[model samples]
Target chain A: MTIEGQGAVPGLTARIFAGHAGPIAVVVLAIVVIWYAGAVYMNAPRQMDVFKRANADWGAVDLIEGTWAQDRPILPAPHQILAELKKTIIDQKVTSKRSLVFHTWVTLSSTLLGFATGAVLGIVLAVGIVHVGTLEKSLMPWIISSQTIPILAIAPMVVVVLGAIGLKGLVPKALISTYLCFFPVTIGMVKGLRSPDPLQMDLMSTYSASPWQTFWKLRWPASLPFLFTSLKVAVAISLVGAIVGELPTGAQGGLGARLLAGSYYGQTIQIWSALFTAAALAAAMVVLVGVVERVVVRAMGGRP
Target chain B: MTPSPVQSGPAGSDGDSVVRAHGLTLSFQTADGPVHALSDIDLEIGRGEFVSLIGPSGCGKTTLLRAIADLEQPTGGNLSVNGVPAHEARLARGYGYVFQAPALYPWRTIERNVTLPLEIMGMAAGARREKARDYLELVNLSGFEKKFPWQLSGGMQQRASIARALCFDPDLLLMDEPFGALDEIVRDHLNEQLLQLWAKTQKTVVFVTHSIPEAVFLSTKIVVMSPRPGRIIDVIEADFPRERSLDIRETPEFLEVAHRVREGLRAGHSYDD
Candidate 1:
């Protein structure tokens, strides 16, 4: 019947390559150019001195106006930040205890531990709630209400209460991260588990498949995309929790401590730098989730 | 007919009588009330026989097929396939069933969808792949193995679903208006292919359809049913040659069989109303 002639043309490969390559290449080139420009401006010795002097003057007006002062101010310019980043990253071993790396490590550890704990608890809760109608109806409202109480207002009380019980350091910070991270995972997972259609469920039933088999095969695979999406949100919130935990307790190291120290002495540059580092770390964590998503979905025979 | 076992070939042979359901009565607890979906539905389909059940929309044709497939339990009556209870028959005999719509799993590729039953049966990987390819070829969907259900047309998806049903080489095939959703052209094409497949495999088929012409064109026996407590009104036997083609639809015997089916349908509808 010559029906084979009706098949689709094999041009999808070239089309996909052309569609993705151009935009990706342009974005990468733009980032590189911007980084090079910033590096050149920040590393120039004369520009660095002039910017340091202006920052020291605290003529915050001139600071915003991009003018230079004679003497070094407390806050450094973009040039100064670039020089500091280069010195810390390239020349000096800033990753050690004497540098910012020790603080970053402290913050990262708490965030990771809290994120893991929160994610596990949240998934277990979501599974329970989804399976049990009474728990879903009763607990969902309270979980939502818990989010309304601002973490900032509660952080001090948590620190004091835990301190009275002699629990300090990582525990309090991990608790805060867990509190912030769990809600999204629970909500996302509930929706995901319920995402499978009735017909699909019936198909499983028609096969005489047990409840566990149906869950593992259909519901779990369907929930994956949602799980990863919520994981990204949960990870970011965990980092926020760690930083917030540090704020009330006044931790000796970590980015939160750096932020508090910067605010105390009005070292706005140090605060900004720490804030940037936290943001970068959060972005990296989310990207890690995306990579895992690709691998897992592919393993499940799904296209990205 | 006192529900005799209609044997066409040797006992336990491929073309021997496979299913016999007598005095099947089905009632459903509908929102309106307890509705009798089917009653006094005595039928026997021989192995490799292509039989169609035709009636009005609410005439319980699908219900009858579902009863045979063990998907629906009859309120009062007996349904036995291969001398076993319908459920046991289904579990042991493993009949393939196709619904009104192509209930293809959206997440699976076409090949994967066809492989689903095999996966459930725990067939070895190499054997499953070979069977999947063979069934896909039978349904004329050889190259579309990797395509998702959403990527295919309605006709193609339905064909893929048919492939899925046929993959395990089931003894009896239960179809509930499987081609009722397709357009006339696609329907004609699928009907021809189905005839060829039936001829090749000699599988027992119990097809439910509303179209009188389709029932006449495809079946060796057409069981005309009445609605509102559906009962078998009449059974019209097709006297055409087994090697019938699409062009046979234009022939005199074909027209005669279709006319008798229509008359039976009209009689049933008038009696019901």
Candidate 2:
């Protein structure tokens, strides 16, 4: 018997969309609407000045259109940024320097490298902090103080110093990302590694398990959830680091370079497009980490 | 309350003593001041005997157990396990201690949980698996090897934990209220199974519980204790048969022993003022 035509029964597809996609769609729509309004408000004076200079009369509709369609508006409209994204990311060849795809790849490489190095560094530091009392006392203060020195202020110095030593290109940029990302990872991991309850620790002691064995069997696994959590934050911030790294160096490639070029040219659409692309990239990386977390949690017999 | 007379080592036909404590005391150096957890505890547990420490909260029954397990450092007194110092016995893996909570690692499956101690002790993979299998079967958890700790009921999880404790084949089992969190029905069932386990393995069991029925049901000797500096007030002997069942609880002999334990517990509380 078909259960399709019951009274007041919403279709499954409709129900699914209502529960999951509906709210997100509304939020995005609201954001786009607000963005469009902000664009017109910011760009109108420039359009008005252009019209007055050209001795051309313009109605409200013309003025609105002018603001939205400006060659170099103060704040580009959503459609303009989307058009620029399509031109650079989809229309242009990926190998082309003008292509956002190429730029994204350049930035992504450094981001990944920095994230890997930073994660390893963070884990090592955390382990040392947990196991060695002196390291905890000595290294922790310095580590905290290191983060207090603004990354932006340090980024240029790091680039210049590393460049002087002939360590240029990806290494310098990745190092900046490493600097920005490692703090969260270190803090999260220290907490995670120590997350095991007293009972668990007591159990290990009872088994006469070596400290090494205890670390591998109990602390490592216990720290996994925390590690993944820190990784998501680390990955996202590392992208920020990569972008900032590109800024001081005036890099020839990368999303940061695209943003730099766009800012130099006063190409608002290009800048906004680069920003959206960076945001999408960060989201993708976090999602990738979350996927791995799910797989690990499931494998360890937890509900993913 | 006066300290109970120290039970001489090698009680009855149980042979040599497994755990012997003389004036065992633990004081936690708290912010307020030093807090006595256990004071002047003296006891001797024989091989292959089930001994239960029955006391109220803050009575140092668990502290005493922790002392035996070497989980807590005794500030004053001499304690030995298997003729060596408690710490040394722990290093030798001479005993397995079970906490009030199952404390099973959420990440490990039932069988894997059982094999944890073996893995830590560097037992080979094949051997660990075999021993895990045997212990799981012994605890009646054979088919649920792949199931995680969270998948099982509270009683089952506790049983799996017991299997984990037993897998390493430690001659002495130190359990601190293993079934305290469980329902009365589950507790009774587990108490029976524990008795069967103790009988089969012939291992010395030091159990901690607040329930008198549980203590009388399981222990061949019950150490009734008091709080406020935490000391034992009385030690009562339970001479029930080794092969006894749950039906033994209804027997006149079991009730008499249980009544004596209740009196000892009340008498321990009388000096609270």
Each prediction's TM-score against the native?
A: 0.75, 0.95
Clashing pairs in 2: none
Given candidate 2, what's the lDDT at residue A56? 98
**Which pairs of residues have clashing backbones in candidate 1?**
A53-A71, A54-A69, A55-A73, A56-A72, A56-A73
Top model number, lDDT: 2
Runs off by more than 4 Å, candidate 1 = A1-92, A96-100, A129-149, A153-168, A295-304, B1-42, B72-82, B90-93, B106-109, B143-154, B225-233, B263-273
Please write out the lDDT profile of model 1 over residues B1-273, one tens digit for every residue: 111122222222354467777778999997989999998777777766788899998889988887877778899988888778888877664688887788887677888899887888789989988898999999999999888787799999989988888888887888989999899999999998998898888887889999877887898877888888788887766656667788888888788878877877787786423
C-alpha displacement of B163 in model 1, angstroms? 2.9
lDDT of 1 by residue, A117-155 (tens): 999988988888988899999999999998999999998
Superposed by TM-score, candidate 1 places the C-alpha of residue A10 at a distance from the truth, in angstroms, of 29
> In candidate 2 chain A, where is summed lDDT lowest over 10 consecutive residues?
A3-12
The deviation in Å at residue B142 for candidate 1 is 3.6
* Share of native C-alpha contacts between chains A and B (below 8 angstroms) recovered by candidate 2: 0.83
As a whole number from 0 to 100, the lDDT of residue B121 in candidate 2 is: 84
Candidate 2 CAPRI assessment class: high
